[model samples]
Target: MPRGAVRVDLNISLDGYATTTDQTPENPFGHDWGRLVGAYTATRTFRARVLGDTSGAGTTGVDEAYAEAYFEEVGAEIMGAGMFGLHDHGDDPDWRGWWGENPPFHVPVFVLTHTPHPTLEMEGGTTFRFVDTDIEHALELAHEAAGGKDVRIGGGPTTVRQFLAAGLVDRLHVAIAPILLGRGIRLWDDLRGLEAGYDVVAETADSGTIHLTFRRE
Candidate 1:
């Protein structure tokens, strides 16, 4: 069978920031993070995965539809070390991750970092393998472990920008929140005229978040 799609999903601010500068140990996602991902967090899928809430207490409309699409056919995930809490927990050898014992991703998750760490096996099928390799090599490893399913590039802006620059991403879905972060990691920085290569489509959810999908043409 052919290899699966390489996808990237991110929640960015109106000003194109994927994160804010106010991130700290206590506030891992920072001040604007919550607002940026409010639509997604209010979805049933996120509540189920992150909060372990199967009581079905989230929105079931447009936002939830996109949230459901995020987990469909994903067999592997690649993320930046910052997303895995390596920037904060780099020195701590016992720091598992931001997610407790059972992470949402039940597939092999490759964490890109400069300092390689041992493979961490969590409660679920989520195994975090720290790698110091380049993007191509990391994708190769992830593809091999995907078992013919789609590979997701779970990001922190910089990592997603790297893959975007390398022309490695096949599809990208971004949820643009109405907030303006002013100064954080900008997703569109140095990516001038980047949309020319993709067949783009946009939709607005009832919660006011704009969903944009880009598929390489």
Candidate 2:
């Protein structure tokens, strides 16, 4: 039997916006706001486990702690096509991969997309597989590839909403930033009237973000 779990990890403004209205290349976020995600992505454990690099060590105590807690058990990842850039118009057919030279997810990554694309093999052990079926199909594929380890649901709000609304997500990790974007993508927008509920499993706050974990009840 394949052992895996799905969890959402994202940073959002206090007013609830993952990215600003103009989600173009010029302004990824609105108004140069919020803390840089680089710091969170630079953790030693995060680098080693996700990026397949040997460098990096515990810098900030909190950062190191969160890295250890979140990344220790991940074996696979599932993401939305928007997060993987499948909807982006580009000449290169292989332009869907998230990280350029080296992506952070070293394990199998199942990307949810409407169009069927070939599987992408990147440096290290990461392979981005496009799933044109549905969120449940992607989860099943992720679980099959994960062996006995956990499967992380890398999000773009819409994808997370699909899973949450279906009651398929087992866990969620939300990092609420202190800044506010006023308008953009929202985490709870699509899940407004869902009959699902999440029980708080853990909560923590830092200078830039507040981390919260939830388990379906």
Candidate 3:
């Protein structure tokens, strides 16, 4: 079996923000969160995986291609506490995740957080394991759990930045939406000249979102 790859996929705004601070229970992405990932949400893959819509009422172009690629060959997922609903759940022991019952990720998900929570086993083969460790240890555990398949770095920006800064990311995909989020968590701060270590490519889809791929050189 081929070795697993460390990959990350993110939807960022034109101003390079991955999330807004105005997140509410109703509006998870905050003020302009939808605008950043509207294209992705309308993809066929997203509809099928997230909404469980089998009617195929979604687009099938470049955006859909990227959306499909996001799940390709992925066997395990690593995410931050924020991405796993820690910020919203706080100390709620019953909070499983924002994704009810069956989550879109049908694999083992290792959540990085300081708060230790019991392992959660949900429907569709999704298991949530919380770890309070560094990026190296987290990746080691995720890689082991990956079982020789690709490991996806699911994000809310902060976690991805930490992995990238630590040079543990092998491949990165970022979709840049055509909007400016003046206030939010920026993804490219203090990471100047970060593209030098990767073979980069950029494509602009019809939805006006630029999809960027960075493969380690």
Which candidate comes out best when scored by lDDT?
1
Q: By summed lDDT, which 10 consecutive residues of candidate 2 come out lowest? A: 30-39
Candidate 2 on 1-217: residue-level lDDT in tens? 8576677777677776666564457776534343535446666776777666776653555655776778667889988888887666434675745577568787899988777788888877789988878777778888889887888888877788788888887787676766666777777776765434777754554555667677767
Candidate order by decreasing TM-score: 1, 3, 2
Instruction: Provide TM-scores for the models.
Output: 0.94, 0.82, 0.93
For model 1, how does the per-residue alpha-carbon lDDT over 1-217 read when each residue is reduced to its tens digit?
A: 5789999999999999988787888987677778989999999998987788989899888899999999899989999999999998899999999978998899999999998699999988999999999999999999989988999999989999999988899999999999888998888888877788899999999999999999999
Residue 152 of candidate 2: its Cα lDDT?
A: 87
Candidates in order: C-alpha RMSD to true structure: 1.6, 3.2, 1.7
Q: Ten residues in a row with the worst lDDT in model 1?
A: 27-36
Give one digit per residue, the lDDT tens place, for model 3 in 48-134: 988889999998889999999987889889999999899979699999989788888889999999998999999999999999998
Stretches of candidate 1 exceeding 4 Å from the true structure: 24-29
lDDT of 3: 0.89
Relative to the unseen true structure, what is the C-alpha lDDT of residue 20 in candidate 3, on a scale of 0 to 100?
66
